[model samples]
Target: MSKRCLSSAMLKFAIAIMTLILLISFSFISSGAYAQEKISILIPEDPTFHDLDSYLDIPVVMVNNTDINVGGFDFLIQYDTGAVELLDVNLGPVDHCNWALIGHRPEIPGVEKIYAASGPNPLGCDFSYSTDTLFYLQFHIKPDTANECLTFPLRFYWVQCADGHVINTVGDSVYISDSVYDPYIGDFIQQDDTFPTIHGLPDSCANIPGGNKIKLVDFYNGVINVACIDEIDDIGDINLNGIPYEIADYVLFQSYYIYGPDIFNIDLQMQLGATDCNKDSTYPTVRDLIFMYRVIIGDISPYPKLGDDGNELIQPTALFVQDTLAQEVHLVFPDSLSAIHLIFEGEIVPDYSGPEGIAYNYDGIVTRLLLNPGFSGTDSAVYQGLFFTYTGDGIIDSADVSDWEMRDIASEVGVIGELICGDANSDGLVNISDAVYIANYVFIGGNPPFPLESGNVNCDGAVNISDAVWIINYVFIGGNDPCDADGDGIPDC
Candidate 1:
């Protein structure tokens, strides 16, 4: 256009540049000819915690720990369409490649996958990469109403894009690749408006080998495991039973104590069970356990506490020094005894009686049989009781309900029999009863998974009907034992 003819030196310079490009390409042809064993395209293994309908960003790493050297690269990424939507792809921070050719090969027949490639930048080895991030992918989690945790994978594929441009083997979009430098224009431009196969497909899709390549050991796919734990608003209603007091609620209480905040991280229903079981402005304590036991045994109620006259409200367990006695009570009770102090409540007419010395009384309540008549500060027998019932804000007396309620039968954290994980009943066995317990608890708000961690028979970390079915399969059907392999709870054998 400038009316000037090309100078000889300029022509020579252009030829030299082209010659150098060919030489560099051929040099890589040898360096990358043999696939190395250490080459691997890795996705993040740790779970990607993403919000529903929200975007999640993850890294695509390539750990090339071998002598293989390559100047270009390409691969296809596949994912579950229903669970996530791939939004965008970006080059990693390292000197991976100067430019990348990315497109969706939607023409493919089956699951969707993305075809991405990089290189040919006259710039020096942009990808002799060893342990580096290759690409960062952003994904949007599709909205679904799963009440429990679920895992979805993001893996690499060996798709042969077919038409020389990888359209059929790639994912869902129009293809773009071939590029070349124009001599007269003196700059690189799109010579063929199509994605080039210069970079071969993922090693597994090896029909067409590119000029530069790397041998990948395996497809280290990653996942985004989403947890859909619902938050319960009611106090002590851990299992979502209408009332806050039940065997199921107690089971969750044990889990909350053992796993701590992590359990809450999985289920927000424990929020009420944790933040304030008694509304005392404090998180759950043994006091809450005692309270839960009272409600379970029909001794107290979390509902509007109205007296018989329907006017005055009386909290049943006012006698025990409220709170601050979980461990102390566990330490009491040297051993099992017969005549235990049956401490219920004095607010109900100050006195009441039940079968076999099971009664609720107050105001000079303890006799010598109960606490040596005048003994205080703890009797020699540790609250000096045996086989007593504190099933109530209705039961516990001023004689320290801790010794009874906090016994190993299920202290603040555990139950009587928690040998393995599938024991939903905790009655020292895993059988139809445990399955029935989980089913009733999961479907009808009956009782929770006993031992808190026991009901996860399937080991997916949440107790549900699937676990009940697994128990059925193991019980009468002779399946794997209940112990999980992780050893976080007990031995697997």
Candidate 2:
């Protein structure tokens, strides 16, 4: 045996030992892999558009497998902070074990840990499962992710009795049985007397009895999608009066907030991409109302609220609410635009004007004119624009987030200026008294409007009771304005 020959032999011996070790290790490694095949973890298939900051639930299901008992189980979920905010979690209906436990403290930014055992001392009791959800996660989409399609990964970061698993062993060979077992020899598997029957683990049968020991589990990952709507609309238009982020919307939103949508027939769906004035939720809140108030009072700022998010929202150049009951119409500006113009077919009264109180004229199949081209503030003056209403059905109904989109009232009108479009009695203001006077003139043959056009509030080419009723609703119930003769978005008589 020369030194070179001895070295070669030693190398060969080392290789032989390493190969033997690997072969032995493969047996134990392959033992628990069957769990992944027998078990499954599934997330929700909720394709419905979940509004940002709206709450939702994600279920973790285990399906398509024969019944199996779990003696102990442990796992953790990973999520994205930008996409959702984890609120709470609930154990599956079948997850009731002797000592089922779960904790969701943000120990890690996006991680939630959970664990359960049949018995504390030995982690027994075996929770059986076939096809059922294992757990549920409660979350709300973050408002900041509005108008964005985001995908967050849902995966189990850790699973006990499977990952980093161990079995009754001597040194190398694993005693993979539930009963006190027998093993190969020294350093690997001798004779063991401990029980490793973790019902939470998958079935196994390697030198162990009953094949009820813990085994490795194969894991699958999934994703949840947060998407924008088919098309973006107005933000403040809770009632969808075609005016985004304006006084009419604010009024509707305020009403809805105070009385709820059901009472006012307000459609929240109309607020899809709109609403959320404070940018905290897709739904309206007190904070949003406060923000809108500030904007109206000219105290608006992005601080403490929302920055410019490029979401599509149509701001109504002018909102015309129709009062069919009072046979009246009222014009409003959701925003401030100078040199505004309004055109009508029936007629417009200069009994009420604004800022400079100037009226202009136009020529067409329908007369085009300036309803209020130079109004500084609408608080009192703008609210009174075309103050008319209609009581055709006896109920006061306002537009919602779905009714109509903001249509540009600016057109090639023959003339334009703010010159009191209503006031059938030529009063400085338009109110219920005007409705009464016009009603007297039409039905009772009493004193009629001085110009008659003042009495034609709806501009329907008539001074009938319908116009009086509309005006009454407008004054008493805040009816909509600028009645569209054909339901077209544009305001006209």
- TM per candidate: 0.31, 0.30
State the weakest 10-residue window (summed lDDT) of model 1: 306-315
lDDT computed for candidate 2: 0.44
- Displacement of the residue 90 alpha carbon in candidate 2, Å: 1.6
Candidate 2 per-residue C-alpha lDDT over 1-493 given as tens digits, one digit per residue, 9 for 90 to 100: 6999878756655554454344333432232122322444444333222456666556655432323554444556677776777887777444444444433455467877654444334433332334445566777777775536656665554323332122211113222222211111112121222223112223323335433343333334446666563344455566677766676765555445323444346455666336566443444433455555555556654222111211111222234433333455554433333332333543333334354453423232332333221124443224425633322222122222210111222211111112233465544467755666565556434445544566676778888877766665555444445243344555575
Q: Rate the local accuracy (lDDT) of all candidates.
A: 0.44, 0.44
Candidate 2, superposed: residue stretches over 4 Å from native: 1-37, 45-49, 92-96, 100-107, 120-129, 158-218, 230-493
TM-score of 1: 0.31
> Per-residue lDDT of 1-493 in model 1, one digit per residue for the tens?
3334436545544554454344433433332321243455556544443335655567765545444453334456556777777676655443434434544444343234444444344423334434555556777767775613577755544335443231211223222222222222334343222233223332333334432222234345566656443432466676665665567767666555433434555457455444344333345554455556556666665421111211111111211221112211112222332222323333222221323232333334332113211112232233322133232232233332232222212221122422356766544567766776676567434436534577877767778777776666566545566754453545443
Task: Report how far off residue 120 is in candidate 1 (Å).
Answer: 4.8
